[model samples]
Target: MLIKTFENKRIGIDELTGQVISGVTFLNCDFSKVDLSETEFVDCIFYDSDRQLGCNFRSAKMKGASFKRCDLSVCAFNFVSALGLEISECKAQGADFSSASFMNVISHKSWFCSAYINKSNLAYTNFSKVNLERCELWDNRWTGANVTGASFSGSDLSGGEFNSFDWQSADFTGCDLTDSELGDLDIRTVNLEGVKVSRDQMSELASRLGINVLG
Candidate 1:
C-alpha cells in the first residue's frame, strides 16, 4: 500500500527520523533544517517524474540521512548541509546538487566534506560546480553525471564505473581510483596528480596512450 503524499508541507525536525518510510511521495515540500539523521527511506519518490517537479531541501541538516533502494531522480538538493549523508543502492538520476554545500565553514579556506554515496546509480546527476572534496564516494555508477567544474579532489572513488563520463569536466586530483573502469580517460590529457591506481589499471592507462609497459 502507498503511504501518505506530502506536498508543500513544512515537516518538523523530529517528524521523520530513525523510521522506515516506504512508497511515500514528497512533492514541493520544505524540509529545511530538519534533522533527518539516520532516517531510512525505501522506495520513496522525492521527485515527480510525470510533472518534472522536485522537493526542496535548501539548507536542511541531513547528517547521516540514509536512503536505501529509493528513487531520488531529479530531486533538488540545493544548499543542503548534508554531512554524512548515506545514499547506498539507490537511483539518484538527474538530481540537482549544483548549489549544495557539504562543508562546515570554519574559515574561508578551511573546511571539510563528508558523505557516503556508495553502490548506487547516480547517472546524469547534476553536481556542477559543487565542492565534494575529501568525501567517500566509492563504487557508484556515474555514467553521464554532470560534473562540470565540480571538484572530487582527495575523494575515495575506487571501484566506480565511469562509462561515457567526461574526465576533464571535473577536478579529480588526489582521488583514489583503484579497481575502477576508467573509460576513455586519457592520462596525458587530464591531470592525475596524486591519483592512485593499481598496477593493472596503470597498464591499461598506458595502453590507451599507446605506450608499451613491457615487464
Candidate 2:
C-alpha cells in the first residue's frame, strides 16, 4: 500500500500491521501506542509539519526506511529490524533502540543523546557527524562502521567491537570504552582525554606506539 499526503491523521494500530507502505508522507500524525510490528515501510517521510508531535515505531520491522529532518525524539525503536535505514538531520534524544538489528544504516547530523543501543548489531553503518553524546552502546557489534566526526562524549561504549574504522575523527571525551575490542587502532589521532579504557587496553595502545611497557 502506498500511503501519500497523510497529514494530521490519527492512524490506529490495527491499520499498520502486515502492510507494505511506500512513499508515505506522514506529517504531524499520531503514531503513539501503535504496534507497527511485521510492518514494512519503504521510502517513507515522517516529519513535523508546523508541529512537533512525535511518532513511534517501537518494535517495528522497517526495512529500507528513510526519514529526513524529522524530530523522532519520542519514538522507541526497541527490538526493531531496520535494515538500510537512513535518518538525516533528525533528533532522537533519550530514545530506546536496544536489541535492534540495523544493517547499512546511515545517520548524518543527527542527535541521539542519552539513547540506548545496547546489544544492537549495527555492522557496516555510517554515522558521519552524528551526535551520539551520552548514549548507551554496550555490547553492540559495531564493526566496519563509519564514525567519522561522531561524538561519543560521556557515552558508555562497553564491549563494542570497533574493527578498522576511522578513530581519528571520533570524539571520546569522558566516554567509557571498557572491554571494547579496538583492534590495531592508531592512537595518534584518537581523543583519549578522559576516556575510560581498561589497563590492558592502555598497555596495548602503548605497545603499538613503541612505548616501553616494562619497568
Candidate 3:
C-alpha cells in the first residue's frame, strides 16, 4: 500500500498509534497535541523546501514513535512528551526540541528519560536546558547544536561528530564517547568524570592539554 501524503495542511487526527507510515510527505503541517505512540514513520518528509519550514509537533504525545530515514529539518518539537522516541538516520538539522520531555515521572523527584536518537543529523538543533540523561544518542552529528544547560549524563554518545560544539555548556558526565570525534573537547575544562573514551581519544585529549604521553 502507498503511504499518504499531506502538505500545508492542519492535521486533525488525534490518535495515530502503532501505524507504519512510510514515504509520507507532511510539508508545513500542524500536528500539535497529536498522540503518535508507537507509530513508525519511515522515509518521510516533514520539511518544506519552498517555504523553508517544517511540520509542527508542539505538545505532541510521541511516546515510542520511531522515525527512520526521515527529513525533519527545522521542525518544532517544543513541549513534546517524547518518552522512548527513536529517530535514526534522519536529517533533523535546526530542529527545536527545547521543552521536549522524554521523562517518565514516578514522583516529584523520581523520573527517568528514555530516547534513542542515533545516526542522525542534529546540527544547529536547539536542546537547551533539556534533561536527556541515560538516553541512547550515539553516532549523530551535533555541529553547532545548542545544548546549554542540557544534561546528557549516563548517555551513550559513541561515534558522534561534534564539530563546533560547546561541551562545557552541557553535562556529559558518565557518557560513553568511544570512537567519537571530539572537536575542541578540553579535558582540563570539561568535566568527564566516569565518561568512557578510547585510549587514542584519551591521548588526543591529553595532548590538547599539553601533556606528553610517551608510551
Candidate 4:
C-alpha cells in the first residue's frame, strides 16, 4: 500500500485490523485518535515531514518497524507489542508505553523525556543514550537490557523489576524510589546523589554500602 496514494487521508482503526502494510512510507500523514490494535507493519517507515504534528500509535501493534526523526509526543501505546523495533532520534515526549512489550529492539539517541513506561516488559532491548528525564517507570520488567550512558534523572522508578541488569555509565540522579524493588544493586556503581527514597530503602542501601544504619 503506497501511503502517498492515501495522502491527506485518515486511516481509522477499523481499516487497519491485522493488515500487513509493508514498504509504505507515511510522510505528512495524520494518525491521530486511531486505534490500530494488533496491526502488523514490516519494514515500514512513518514520519511527519512537517515536524509539527505526531503520528498517534494509540494501542497499536508493530513488528520489525523503524522510525527516523519523528515526533511521537503524547501518544498512547498501551498493551502494544513491538519486536525488533528500531527508532532513531525521535521525539517521544509524554508518550505512554504502559504495559507494552518489546524485545530485541534498538533505540538510539531518542528523546523520551517524561514518557510513561509503567508495567512494560523490555527484555534484551538496547536503549543507548536516551533522554528519560522525569519518566514514570513503575512496576516495569527490564531483563538483560543495555542502558549504557542512559540518563533517568528525576524519574519515578517505584516497584520496578531491576534484576540481572548492567547499569554502567547510567545516571539516576534525583529519582524517586518509593516502594520500589531495587535488589542486588551495588550502590557504589551508579550515580544516585540526592535521590528520593523511603527510610527503609535508605537502610537497605546503607547496609549494602557496609554502613550500619542504626535507627
Candidate 5:
C-alpha cells in the first residue's frame, strides 16, 4: 500500500483489508467508497482512477488498467490478470473470474451479476450493455467479440468460442450452449427464449428462423 503521484488523491473510506499492493502507482487516484476487501494487487498501476460505491477489487491484479465509473461489487477476481483493461459503468457482482485473462478488454454498461467466469480469456472483448446473470462462462474465448446488449441469464457457455461475434440484442436465457460454437453468426434481435441450444444449434437457427434476419 504505497500510493505515488499524490495529486487530487482521495482514497475514500480506506480499509485496504488483507493488503498486499505491490509496486503501486496511482496517478490522479480517487478510490471512492473503498473497502478493498481481501485486497492483493500485485504490480499495481491505476492511472486516473475513480472507484465509487462499495469498491472492493478482491484478489485483484487489474493488469494494464484504466477504470472509469467503478463500483465493483462482491469483487473476487479469482486468478485475475485483466489484460489490457478499460472498464465503464462497472458494478460487477459476485465477481470471481475463475481463470481470468480478459485480453483487449473494453466494457460498457457493465454489471456482471453472479460472475464466476470459468476458464476465461475473453479475446478481443467489447461487451456492450453487459449483464451476465449467474455467469460461469466455461472455456470462454469469444473471438473478435462485440456482444451487443449482452445479457446471458443463468450463463454457463460450455466449451465456449463464439467466433466473429456481433450478437444483436443478445440475451441467452438459461444459457448453456454445450460444447459451444454458434457458427455462421448473425443472430438478429437476439433473444433465444429459454436458450439451451444444441442439435447443431437447431440447424443453424433454420435460416434465421425463417427470414427477417435483421431485415
Candidate 6:
C-alpha cells in the first residue's frame, strides 16, 4: 500500500485500517471520525489535528506528536512511545498502552477507561477531568502530575509515586494504593471518604484531620 501524506488536508470519515504508514506526517490535518484500526505508524507525526470520534492509532510510535481532541478509543498502543506529546480532550477508552512511555506529556480531559498502562511515565502530566477507570498503572511515576477531577475507580495504582501533586476532586473509589507514595501531599479537596488507606497513610490522614498525636 502506498502511504500518502495528507498534510493540512480536510478528510472526514475515511477508513484507513490495516495500512502501514511508516514515517508519515500529517500536519494540521482533519481526520475526524476516521477508522485507522491496526495501522502501524512508525516515526509518524500528527500536528494539530481535529479527530473527534472513532479513530484508531493502535500500536503506533506517536512520538513527539501533538494531538488535540482526537477520539482514540479501543486503540492498541502497546509498546508505543509517545514521548514529549501534548494531547487534550481525547477519548481513549480501552486503549492498550502497556509498556508505553509517555515522558513529558501534557494531557487534559482524556478518557482512558480500562486502558493498560503499566509502568508508564506520567510525570508532570495534567490529567484533569480524565477517566482512568480499571486502568493498570502499576509502578508508574506520577510526580507533580495534576489529577484534578480524574476518576480512577477500580484501577490498580500500586507502587506509583504521587509526589507533591494536587489531587483535588480526584476519585480513587475502590482502587488500591498499597505501597503507593502519598507523603506530604495536599489532598484537601480530594474525596477519600470510603477509600482504603494503609496504616502509615491513615496516620498521615489523621494528621491532616487535626488529630493531636502526642509523642
On TM-score, the candidate that comes out on top is 3
Give all candidates' CA lDDT scores.
0.85, 0.62, 0.94, 0.58, 0.53, 0.55
TM-score of 3: 0.96
Q: Using TM-score as the measure, what is the rank order of every candidate, best first?
A: 3, 1, 2, 4, 6, 5
Q: How does candidate 4 fare on TM-score?
A: 0.49
Error of 2 at 167 (Å): 0.5
Task: Give residue 151's error in model 1 in angstroms.
Answer: 1.3
Please give, for residues 84-151, the per-residue lDDT of candidate 3 as tens digits.
99999999999999989999999999999999999999999999989999999999999999999999
Candidate 4 per-residue C-alpha lDDT over 65-149 given as tens digits, one digit per residue, 9 for 90 to 100: 4443444443445545554344434445444555455533347744334345554455544555555666666666556555676
How many pairs of residues collide in each model? 1, 0, 0, 1, 0, 0
Q: Each model's TM-score?
A: 0.86, 0.51, 0.96, 0.49, 0.27, 0.48
Each candidate: RMSD: 2.5, 12.4, 1.2, 13.4, 13.7, 11.2
Q: How does candidate 4 score on lDDT?
A: 0.58
Winner on lDDT (3 vs 4): 3
lDDT of 6 by residue, 1-215 (tens): 56556555654443454455555556555543444434444545453244522333434445444433443443444544454344433444433445444543357745334344444456655556556666666666677665666777877778778876566657887777777887555546566655556777767766887874454
For model 6, where is the 10-residue window of minimal lDDT?
47-56
> What shift in Å separates residue 156 of candidate 1 from its native position after superposition?
0.8
Off by over 4 Å in 3: 1-4
Worst 10 residues of 2 by lDDT: 87-96
Q: Write the per-residue lDDT of candidate 5 for residues 91-146, one digit (tens) a residue.
A: 34333344444433357744334444444445645455555555566766676555
* TM-score of decoy 5: 0.27
How are the candidates ranked when ordered by lDDT, highest leading?
Answer: 3, 1, 2, 4, 6, 5
